[model samples]
Target: MDGPFATAFSLIASGDPALMQIIGLSLRVTLTAVLIACAVGLPLGAALALARFPGRGAVIVVFNALMGLPPVVAGLIVYLMLSRSGPLGSLALLFTPTAMIIAQTLLILPIVISLTRSVVEDLWAEYREQLLSLGAGRLRAVPTLLWDGRVSLLTGVLAGFGRASAEVGAVLIVGGNIAGHTRTMTTAITLETARGQLGLAVALGIILLTLTLTLNAVAWGAGQWARGRLG
Candidate 1:
């Protein structure tokens, strides 16, 4: 353990290009997945919350349940669906970054929807009466409510990104952890650890933790700044 720890520290201090590439690739995939999640999930969540159609409650319930789904299950589903003999086999997306991104989007979409729904619900409760009293129609109030809940929406997005970036099981299965190709920090850590190369694994693990912490810190600071400006 001590030897692995020492080697891990040395690897970080050495500025290894391979390690940097892994980190960069992980960041790229996670950022892309999160952005895609927001683009699709935000409006859907807001609409689900503000709309008064039948079965809205059922949809919210399903989304909330999906928010707690196991990542390994999601990985298995994507792997099966994108495998060579599967329906999407012709696209040849398996073991690729795009596949990993797709799996991650599936994993985090529920979180985005559920969290954003909660945010919208709160805003609706607070402002619905006032907006309606002022002769504002439903369409006018929807955007206003969303704007007021911007901080919560941002927090939800940060939460989704955090979830996507930290996930290992799904990316590992769907991406195949191919070295110098589909390899990401999480996948690298898992492969190295399995191969008993504790030093490399621990090094990669440290890198992942550092990236996650840095991202969360930035999100927190940004959310605080946004709230202050709004106030």
Candidate 2:
């Protein structure tokens, strides 16, 4: 443990190019996927909060269930779709960062959508009558509720980011974990472990743990801020 921790600290202190590259690609893929998920999920979730259509309960159930979708299943789905004989194969996105991004997006999208829906729905439940009295239809009230719920919604976003950053199976499948191309922190750690590079793997694990801790701290701070505002 001491030796591995020493190596981990040394790698961090030295800024090894390979380590930095893995970190950069991990951030790039995860951030892009989070952005895409939030962009699509936020408004859609707000709409789900406001909509009163039939079978809405079913839709909600499906999304809530999807929040638990396995990483490997998500990877396999992307792999199949991106394979040469698959419908989207023509785009040649398989075994690339873009493919990894897509896979992560799928994994995290349900989480974003489900949590956003819960936040906005609670806000709507409290404000619906007032919003209606103001001549604002349900559709027109979405943005207002979404804005008001922004702090709470941030927890969902950060959760999605954490999920994306930690996931190895999905990205590995779609990105091929190729050196200097698709390799990311999590996948690199997996490879390093397999090759008995325990020190490097432990180093990468330390970095990933730090990142997750930071994200959770941010989420906790946001929750506190929201509570203070409400108080």
Candidate 3:
């Protein structure tokens, strides 16, 4: 058998079209999902942290629990919802990139919301009185707390991205892993390894690892910058 590392490097250096396509699709889907999650999650989380309505505690508990949702279960639910006989089947999203985006977004929403809530809540506790004394209401204070806690919220976004990028179960069920279509890095790796194409699988794995590490590095740098500002 060819050494996996050597073969991986060779494939990468050769700019294999299939590998490039998989990598591109993976980035596009995951990044889009994360952005949509952030749009919904950040506002919802800030509201949860600032509001004190009845049943708020229960709502918070449910969201926190959902952070531990199983990937396969998520995939199953999405699959059912998008199936031909299912509720959203009219949209014809099943076995497509859109379905994959929906699946990943669902998978990461709870994580983003929970972590954002935690960060915003903590910052709100510190800034509440100050904001109130300055004539700021809860609505006005939400933005302030979110801005102050942006670094931590960013970390949460990165966490969601990581979860989206690494997961295969949900996307596989929804996307169908069609070549040059819905296939992504994680799904491609699974396909390659299953077909005993170790070199391609290893190459994809390396690319995935590199992307994840780069994201973490960016988060780390942002955290450091925020700390410096705080100091």
Candidate 4:
């Protein structure tokens, strides 16, 4: 507890194996989750923006509502589904990194969908007439709208990544925080702090903050570069 800063810095400088493993696992899980979310959400969002279906307004409202879904609740849903008595429990995905990734994917999917839908919808409004005049149907128009709004969509992806990386409750519940396996930075920090291992917790916290800041900075820079190129 005493001189936690010094201890944290020392641990980082020394490259403690356990700390490094936690950091690695956290990155792997969050990045995987974000990628999966983007893959599913981006196209779905574009479809929602371009298609004129009945009950569309209600559907958008539901997705927007889901954007604020609690992490623990999402975790609970996943836990039950993966539990032995649950429908999907036969595969035994509970308490694994795969389960953690699934939980995070669910948690961030709404963020990606909502943000992407908003951006694509706005872009579609401006480009709809020109696209129609050019003989472009809904399917062809989706790529054009998506490409034109790439910067904003990228920001949405970054936002999803931020949410996925910072979350603890869902991952902790599904991952079981097992050392050298599913232990991520957020879970490790919680466990260490609870066990009065302030130095280790501080070290993990510093690393997590650094990773988050660096990711945002890179995303901002990429957005700027894209804007410049597209401008």
Most accurate candidate by TM-score: 4
Ranking by lDDT: 2, 4, 3, 1
The global C-alpha lDDT for each of the candidates, from Candidate 1 onward, is: 0.85, 0.91, 0.90, 0.90
Q: Residue 168 error for model 2, in Å?
A: 0.7
- Model 4 Cα lDDT, one tens digit per residue, 60-131: 999999988888899999999999899899989998889999999998899888988999999998999999
lDDT of 3 by residue, 149-228 (tens): 88788888998999999999999999999999999999999999999987778877987898899989988997998889
Per-residue error for 11 in candidate 1, Å, reads: 2.8
lDDT of 1 at 12: 79
Q: Worst 10-residue stretch by lDDT in candidate 2?
A: 1-10
C-alpha RMSD by candidate, in order: 2.1, 1.7, 1.4, 1.3
Q: Which residue pairs collide, candidate 2?
A: none
lDDT of 1 by residue, 1-231 (tens): 466567767877898888778888898888898889888888788778788888888999999999888888888999999999989999999999999999999988998989888888788888889999998876777678777888778888887888888889999999988887788988888888889988778767776787788888988898899989887
What TM-score fits each model? Answer: 0.91, 0.94, 0.95, 0.96
Q: What are the runs in model 4 whose C-alpha is more than 4 Å off?
A: 1-3
Clashes of each: 0, 0, 0, 0
Candidate 3 clashing pairs?
none
lDDT of 2 by residue, 1-231 (tens): 467777778888898898888888999999999999999999999998888899999999999999899999999999999998898999999999999999999989999999999999999999999999999998899889988888889889998998899989899899999999999999999999999988879888998888778878977987897789875
**TM-score of candidate 2 relative to the true fold:** 0.94
